[model samples]
Each structure stands twice: as C-alpha cells, then as structure tokens.
Target: MPAITPEQRVLDNLRDTLQAYVAGDVAATAVVTVFRGQAPALALPEAFQRVLDELLRRLEMADVFSQDSCSFSSTGIQEQLGVWLDKAEARVSARTA
Candidate 1:
C-alpha cells in the first residue's frame, strides 16, 4: 500500500467534504467549518484563498442559510469546486516538480 502525502490527504478530504455538502449531508457544515479553520495554515496564495473563500461562502449559504427556507442546488457549488480542484492540482504538480 502506498502512503498518502499530506497534500493528497487534504485534497481527498476536500473532495469528500464537497461531495457531502452537495448531497445534503448533515455533517457538511461542521466539516467545512473545520476545513476553513485550518485554511490559514495551508499556505495558499491570496488569489486562491479569495476564490476558495467565495466558494466556501456559497456552500455555507446554500447549506446553512437556506436549509429551512429553500432547496439548495449543487450546480454552482460543483462548478466552483471544479475550479478550485483544478487550481489545487496545478499547485500540487508545481510543488512536486
């Protein structure tokens, strides 16, 4: 079995958390909250962080703010997630090279 790198672990966690959020899992908020709590230490560039912050805010708004009032659509969330993942993968590739 191959050992997972910290970067891969983080990415995997993010992917799983995003999937949970999209699926309306009850624990999504807590997971995202914890992830955001550790975001500062991730050493992400300001631009990347800004985009990610927006994505997080959208996810929170969809999941928490409208939980009782309206149904949350995962379309926008998935798009933002794709963007973030692409960028993160690029950064990982650069770092590994």
Candidate 2:
C-alpha cells in the first residue's frame, strides 16, 4: 500500500470541508475548525495556492451571480465547486506529472 502524501491529506480535507459547508454547516467556526491545525502541515507550491484561490474566487462569483439571478441554491454552489475541483485536480496532476 502506498503511503498518503500531504497533498492527498489536504485534498481529502478540502473535499470534506466542501461537503460540510454544503450540508448546512456554513459557519466561520466550522470552516476554521476544518483547516485549523490541518492545513499548515502542507508546504504546497505557490501555483497550488493560486489554484485554490481561484476556486474560492470562482465560487464567490457564482454566489453573486446566483443572487443576481434570484436562483440561489446550495446545490448550485456545490456543483460549481465540483467543476472547480475537476479543473484544480487537473492542474495539480499536470504540475506533478
């Protein structure tokens, strides 16, 4: 069995955090608790951080668009995150490969 790397751990944490956030636990405390003491262990490259920041910004923009369209839905946001994750995962794979 291969050992899990720090990137794997952080990615798993991110998926879990996104799930919890979508499942009505959207609170600052919940988010902080998810990353606190967990995220600092990784020494991810700056490119990876930019990928994450892009995900965040994309989601924020999606939320604003939803508000403007009057079609706000958590599931829509989750789907947006899913697309962002696919893109980010591809970026990471390309970087690592």
Candidate 1, superposed: residue stretches over 4 Å from native? 1-3, 67-74
Q: What does candidate 2's lDDT look like per residue over 3-74, in tens digits?
A: 766666676776688777777667424544554445444555565556545545445554566533634454
What does the lDDT read for residue 14 in candidate 2? 66
C-alpha lDDT of residue 92 in model 2: 53
For 1-97, candidate 1 gives per-residue lDDT tens digits of: 7676777777777777767766767364665685586555456789878887877666677666654343444466666776787778678758866
Query: What is the clash tally of candidate 1?
Result: 0
What TM-score does candidate 2 get on C-alpha atoms? Answer: 0.51
lDDT to native, each model:
0.68, 0.57
Best candidate, TM-score: 1
- Minimum summed lDDT over a 10-residue window in model 2 is located at 28-37
Quick one: RMSD of model 1? 3.2
For model 1 the local lDDT of residue 15 reads 70
Superposition TM-score, candidate 1 onto the true structure: 0.71
